[model samples]
Target: MVFKCQEDSFLKQFKTTIVSCDFATLDWVADDDNRNNGETRQLRGFNVICEDTILFPEGGGQPCDYGTINGHQVRSVQRKGSTAVHFVESPGSFEEGSEVQQQLDWSRRLDHMQQHSGQHLITALFDREFKYDTTSWNLGQSVSHIQLSTPHLISRESLDLIERQANDLIREGREVSVVLVDPATALEFQDARAPRGLPKDHEGLARVVRIAGIESNMCCGTHVTNLSQLQCIKLLYAEKVKTNVHVHFVVGERALRKLGEVFQREQQLTAALKGGASQHLELVQKLQQNVKSTRKSFQLLLKDFATAEAERLEELPKAQRPKYFALHRRDGIEVDFINTLLRNAPEDILYFLTVSEGVAAGSSAKGHMVLRGDPAVVQEMGPKFLELLEGKGNGKENNFQGKINNLAKIEECTALLEAHYKPKKAATAVEPASAS
Candidate 1:
């Protein structure tokens, strides 16, 4: 590698430096995974070396450093030779010659630091207390998890003990130590666990993070120097995958906030039940049943509502043939609406009717709409039908839907269909929004 540490040093918080370097090169190629999508690749951004960066290159299954550099965000940081190559995510303004100020967003950096630190502590606790080796780890956007190489050996009781130990360590507030040891010196510490297929020892310098009395590992990522930096560590969930058990967790501010929000919502639910908190679960089940019943009732109500609507259409003069009907169920949909449409049309006449669940923007909605008429009726009316509702629909079949963007043309839809399809002076049947 180009830039190897010669001595042990820690980055002071929020450090900034300016570097003037000649642009190495730039190119656009298919992103490796897809090999079809073109993504810009600038492998030499590592040329601008800064003193302090919280962005860790991809290590420990966590993603690489991503934040603004000068103004261009460094998408991913990779090690090319001895230099850390920063993958520029967005092209803003940079050149090999143009001086750029490299910086990291400390808040974002610190959050990752806390989580990574928590992971170290938790992993250490699990290994020591339950003898489980962390085989894989992934720190993601909302949660971080690690899989134990031998999951079957870990019982629920064992997991509880690990959680107790990890959180207790967080509460105790230990000083996490990052140490540099020569590869030979690293061998002296027999208990230290390092990832497989990684260098256990280096010639001159190696990076190892020690949770004071808890855990120690060879690491290249940024982390909180003190265990106290992680305000809280929340055990979100755990599940077994293959031979390994994956433990999901959250840390720091988010951990405490999520805990409080979940607790408070459960409390509110229990209060609504008016019984003990134990009854809250049963009460939730009852509420779900009530919603189901209400849905069935709403469908029956829609039949009556549509019946009255079709009744009003019956009152219209015959020339105003109600050849088109676009009924929408804005709040509650009814199955009867679709069934009624299929049953009631005159054999010789053409009619288009639909019941959509929700409006598309302000116009059409999603669901079924069927139109059957002279092929000419649709040829003249389909475009206008979608236009009035401010929606989009196309079909040469008896129907097509993905309509209901707007409801403005419903009346005109009735007017045009009566004039063209029914071709009767008094067949006008204007529909109205269901009052039910």
Candidate 2:
């Protein structure tokens, strides 16, 4: 059904009589693009059907219009058969046959108009120049993209050409008009592209949007009256996904906003890199190289430290050595340190070693641990050690290894290890004292 929005397209406010009001529920789902951790929710309101409305219901790849009815906020509108249903989120109900004031969010309406019209211009230019049919398109919150029915990636030069042509036509200020034609006579217009045929509920006439000297296409979304209203167009990039190529672009104010954002990001990079925009890339690459060199030197130092620690343990007299030893590192997640220490140390002493990511101990800090000793002891201590560190792992008989997350519980784990190997005194017989 043709809507009042399609008829005028620029109407901001209108007085329309309410035809019916019924209790309804709208299931609102979070859009993947702008999701803010909001789950799907049910919105309760009255479905107020109006005699006529300026608010456009969502269809043809365009989102629904947000507006108000009698100063009550209406976040959603939908088309049911041939009627427009306005979901009014008001505690009070509207009387049927009473007049109500409907207001449009002008900024939102204008943005949609510019983008929808801009898409027609882009689709027409692509089909004319490269013979690429636009299979589908999206009108996003910040940017939009059109899917072309082609497997080959669009080149940078082709993008530049299309962008330039689109802007040139925008400057030409060509008229854009919509006309209702009989469904049987839709083919009378030459070069009209209707990928998705007419809607099933559509009865009388089919609506066709025409751009002068360009092309005519069947559409149901609201649009601008002229190409000049688009201001400008910017083609961002093209990416091939599966069988189709998506060409991303922005129109009018969105183009200006995107430019401002890019420039701001460039300024931030210049300050962080201590260089101009042109030198940012080179400076960052040099910084990365320096880090790589430093990390290698650090690893070598850790290996030397591990060797020194092993030698200290080995030098201790056999009688003076403890049954078990525990070592923990908070500097980094280098399990090789544990490996090196185990390899060089005396084999008799049980070793419990850990390496974590955080410089300071934290409950949520992640790390890895290894337990090496007698086969029986390793099997017995593996589960206890993992339980203390809040991690899951299994190990071979004499060598148990696992990943851990609770670095703050390392002290508790160390105490358990020390107690397990602690000496226990033998009890003396008391039978002789009792006989005396």
Candidate 3:
């Protein structure tokens, strides 16, 4: 199949006749188990084949072009053995041999071209300057990355050198050319970098992209005709990935976009933090330290309050004392509060205590409980208490503790515990059996 995009990268619109059209479905498994039975979803669409097309299918580390065909949205484009299949969303299929207008999303196409060409230039420079070869690349939506075949990480100095040289070439406005070279005559080009060699099934000639006085390589993806079209190249950062270093970069309009986004964030931080861009990080660190110190002080205060609350319960009049002493705190009370209370609690006092960590009523809660009066009562009530709060806990002897999901149910759970442990009414005194 002849690809119009390869011949003319700037072709935004073209007229083509539909070679074939059929209903098709794209299927893929979701990353998460969100579906019943974990089945892959099928997206219904139409697979269209055109006599001549400007849409570049996804290949050679570049994404497919997104556009419209006959006013229908083209979702994706894929190459299947020399055939460019255009996946389009349409209610009815286009009839075979029908003429249609194809339009390429120029902004997207230009972005891909800039990134792909920038990668080629960077790859060539790395090889020339450092003997590092590019093994793979990814043309991402927002940024692009090149994987260099090296065990050691790339140094910042080396990256800066390569980036400077690449932008210099862009400023020089060197012409980029694509040529079809016969395999037998490919040896004439000494600067061409073809590590994998030509495919066995590759027809008569291999398509080679050459940057003037720089490097030439076998590439099928689209590119800008001139280096200046790239505007500029910025190497963002590099990281070691297994045996290679993946270098991230942005080119042309994307570099401008990245800069705009960063400056906007800087403005926001300046306004909110009342600090200059250079002082933002230092101020944030200081604020974090202050928060830590304040949190420690608050925790100590809660502990002291918990100790006083336990003492008040102990001082209650004997007649006013309830069968079970229960305390429910809506504020973020820690488990240590319960432990402090238990440490000072009298042996006969059966205690039900809860601390809600969540601020909202329906959020999760955590607590600890101790039943010290009766061994049988502790054993029976421990599991029931956890069940009421929708929690799981473990215990040995008279203590149990766990986390619960329903914070709103804490009051109801405590009430149930009070009722369960309420002393049975004194049995009516039996009158002496004098009548007998």
Candidate 4:
């Protein structure tokens, strides 16, 4: 028995006997696996390097398949030109020439197939319908894009028209045709050309899939046999990038599910916010007013609060000032805490603020506070200052902030400043005029 396939179609099924075999399995797996966390496969399954397999590993910026085959986990799949190989996660070996049952992960493949096919149809609309050539494309897992060769601001009307035409072809159930021809004969279609990303050795014959009369391009990734194989499609997002429109799209079952999810979420949000399933705009206005009023009130409270905190922390001695840097939670204190304290202090004292890692997750922990004051008078209640707190924090410096496991440090930060630097101290200190 003999089976035949197109030169490019050989990745799917071919009965041609192997003319040669060598150790071409990628050894770079160990390096890649190590970089992606610590997942390493211990499979000893037969490493089958076939001339044909439908699996297109993540190459050319496309994601790889994630499914099982024949009960063995084919963890990695790679394709080079027309040849594809499947790396199984097992220890058993299959002879090279063995005729065995083969199957593909259809659910996963069908998704990509439709997406890839849809890209061609849409791309054709740009060229045939608008005379713009696709400059670049990225057929991602969820969305496919095309970069038009010319810069033209595509209006929403243009987008809608193209999308409508593509869907119409899919609805029509047009039979897709895959044809192979020698390179010399391939150049005969002067206007027709293969899609981007084909092997450079085009001197040999190549495989091209044509969508009925809609579109044609080179592709090794699995694609729908007919337009009907691709169900409905929805254009999710489209943004203009210089001369091109960066489109994110969805097709078939996934598109439907996504639309349903969006509508459902919208309805729920309307009900929760506006007391009905449709009063969203009214509710949004009400929310805006409430937020504005609350912000005004918060500003008043914060002004008074920060003033009181600043005044109360003005005059504490170096060792006596508890790690007050945490006062930064009040916003203004972040960079200003040290400066504010220094302003009211005698010049002999140097105010310092330090930050370190916090309890678990936070922007950062404002660690300790230290005031370099007269050493003769300085005594460290400082290290013991943080010892009384919650998490671990100690300092040879003037201040520290830990878990604040101990809240007692708060009293230390505020009291010395409040007791020593009375407001009277500031108003009364007038410097004598220097003799000129």
Candidate 5:
């Protein structure tokens, strides 16, 4: 609906009467069947229509203004036809015809204005300089982007030029004005960019925004009165998205915040790497090389130790051999180490091998397991081992490999195998009955 925000974009507070209040439920689920089956949750808010409001509803690629009405938090604002609906978060509804004070979250409102206006400035420059038409734009939480009608990516040189030109306009303090013009007379203005046509249901004069000697376009979003209010516009980067080139950017306070965040990250990296910002990449590369060398040496040591352990197990007398041979290695040892060790083992050996990410007492421990032995034995015990560890695996012949989550259950799994293969006590025959 036509409101004070349309006439004065900087209005932060106003008093308005409630025209209507209704209970509304916003369903989050996409499918009706899922909503009916309770698979979807609903957000309940009061849709309170105000007689007049300074709160701008979501439109023209700009987000709605968030604030409070009569001390109750306003979560969302939307426009339905000629009516502005305020979604107020309250357990009870506000009384119709009652006067309520409306307060706009000024910080959020100003941020939207800065970004929206910055987009207009940038769009105009691109169209004038490179003949690139803006197909779409997004005002995001941290950064905004405009999609240009170009299949090729925008180059750094072109972005820098546009950015410099836009900032030049900001520095000049160009006057930004909004005017209402009749549809028939709109074409009389020079270089005026109007929408193809007004919506069939749209009534009244069209509103057009003009920047001094720069651009004139039809827009419904709130904007600053002058270009200087935008502070500065920074084109961060650009990339090719399908058929369009999407340019990411930040404006005003958002640009400053982004700069601060980048500086903080750089400081953190410098401290961690013990190097200056310029030397970070080279230092990181050296650190990576060192890690690779260390890992290679550690792997060789594990292989040699596995080989020695396998030989020691094989040299044990058959009668003294354990029913089951299980090895639990620390985290970072690969499953291939188990394969190497089993290569030296006899076919009769039943081995349970595991590499854990953490100690058994901690729940986060996770790793892989490899079982090797007679096909009949593994076939009988493999499923049980996986079931106890809550794991899944596949096998062919005598070798089975899988990932396990509960490393604490490894000992229990091993005991099951040992008990199954343990030698049974011999039974003696009785001859006393024949003698009697």
Candidate 6:
């Protein structure tokens, strides 16, 4: 069925009757699913079918339109057969055959129109100039990309050419019109770039959207009436994914908004780097080089400190030396420091050493640890130490090492090690004292 949205894309308000309303439940997820932190809600609502609506159902790489029905919020609308099913978020039901007011979200509709029409223009230009067919396209939240059939990568020169031609056509202000023709005669007006056939559930005449002096394509999505409404077009870049190349671009208000955002970021970078935009790259490169040199010097200093610590332990007299030694650093992930210390130290005293990332250990702070000395003690303590740190590792003979995260419990682990190696005193007999 030809939807009202397809008939008149500019229509923002329409009066329609509710054909049916059924109990329904929707599992709604956050719009930014990646950063939602595993949050989801079950939306109890009604599946409302309206006789006619300005709300467009999702189709042709375009998302569904969001709006309201009789003052209740409708978040989703989908096509079921020839009808538009509106998912109204409400516990109350809409009476069947009752009159209702349908409202369209104008900003969303305008944005979709700009993007969809821009895709049509771009597709036509690529087919005309490069003989490359558009296999598919994606209307992204920020930018849109069209998958070109060619395997050869598009160069910067080609991107500039296409972008220039697209804006020129937009400047020309060409008229865009839609025509409904008989299914049998549809092929006569549409160009070779048109889709092969109509949708499976398509009824009545086929709709073909035509750009003046350009091309005609079989499309059901809404679009702008004139090319000038697009404002501008900017072809960003192209990327090759396996077999096809995706050419990314922005259209109309999106291009303007993107420009503003980029300029704002540039101002922030200038303040942080203490340089103008022209010198930002050079300053960043120099900063990176300096950091590299400093890191190398710091690593050498850590090794020297490790060697000195080991030498101090070795200088202790045999009788005066403790059975075990524990050292912890609250600065970094310094496994090399632990290895260097063990290399220069005596093998008799059990050693427990750790280096964590923060000054004060939090539950999430990460670190590395090593236990060395007696093979028997190493094997016994390896698994226990991992369990205490909420980590994992394995050991064979004289050393056990692993990565750990829960550093807040390090004191408890140290106490456990201390109690294990504490010296025992000799027992005394009292029989001679009793006789005296």
Tens-digit per-residue lDDT, 159-250, candidate 2: 99999999999999999999888878555443567899878887777888999989999899999999999999999999999999999999
TM-scores of all predicted structures: 0.64, 0.86, 0.79, 0.66, 0.83, 0.89
Of candidate 5, the 10-residue stretch with the lowest lDDT total is: 426-435
Clashing pairs for model 6 are: none
Which rank order by TM-score, best down to worst? 6, 2, 5, 3, 4, 1
* TM-score top scorer: 6
Tens digits of per-residue lDDT, candidate 3, 1-436, equal 4499989999999999999999997773432223445576676779999987899998788888888999998868988767799988788899998999999989889999999999999999999998999999998768799999999999999999999999999999999999887767667444567776765545656778999999898888899999999999999999999999999999999999999999999999999889999999998999999999998886787677767766766786666555666665555647777777777756666676666754444346554334444566677777876787777777777766677656666556555665675564211111123311
Q: Residue 69 error for model 3, in Å?
A: 0.9
Better of 2 and 3 by TM-score: 2
Off by over 4 Å in 6: 30-39, 182-185, 189-198, 423-436
TM-score of model 3 relative to the true fold?
0.79
Which residue runs does candidate 2 get wrong by more than 4 Å? 24-43, 318-324, 377-394, 402-406, 422-436
lDDT tens digits, residue span 85-199, model 6 = 9999987999998999999989888988999999999999998899988989999878999999889999999989988998998999999999887767656455525554667
lDDT of each: 0.61, 0.86, 0.80, 0.53, 0.81, 0.84
What TM-score would you give candidate 1 relative to the actual structure? Answer: 0.64
**True-vs-predicted CA distance for residue 24, candidate 5, Å:** 3.9
Residues 143-257 of candidate 1 have per-residue lDDT tens digits of 7888887747455676677777777777788887766766555663455677663543323466677888777787766777677678877776778787778888888976876
Residue range 42-83, candidate 5, lDDT tens digits:
668799999888999888888888889987878678877777
Tell me how far the alpha carbon of residue 135 in candidate 6 is from the true structure, in angstroms, after superposition.
2.5
Q: How far is candidate 6 from the true structure (C-alpha RMSD, Å)?
A: 7.7
Q: Write down the worst ten-residue block by lDDT for model 4.
A: 427-436
Q: After superposition on all CA atoms, how large is the RMSD of candidate 2?
A: 8.0
User: Which residue ranges in model 4 land beyond 4 Å of their true spot?
Assistant: 1-46, 54-70, 150-153, 187-189, 195-197, 201-203, 274-277, 312-436
Better of 2 and 6 by lDDT: 2
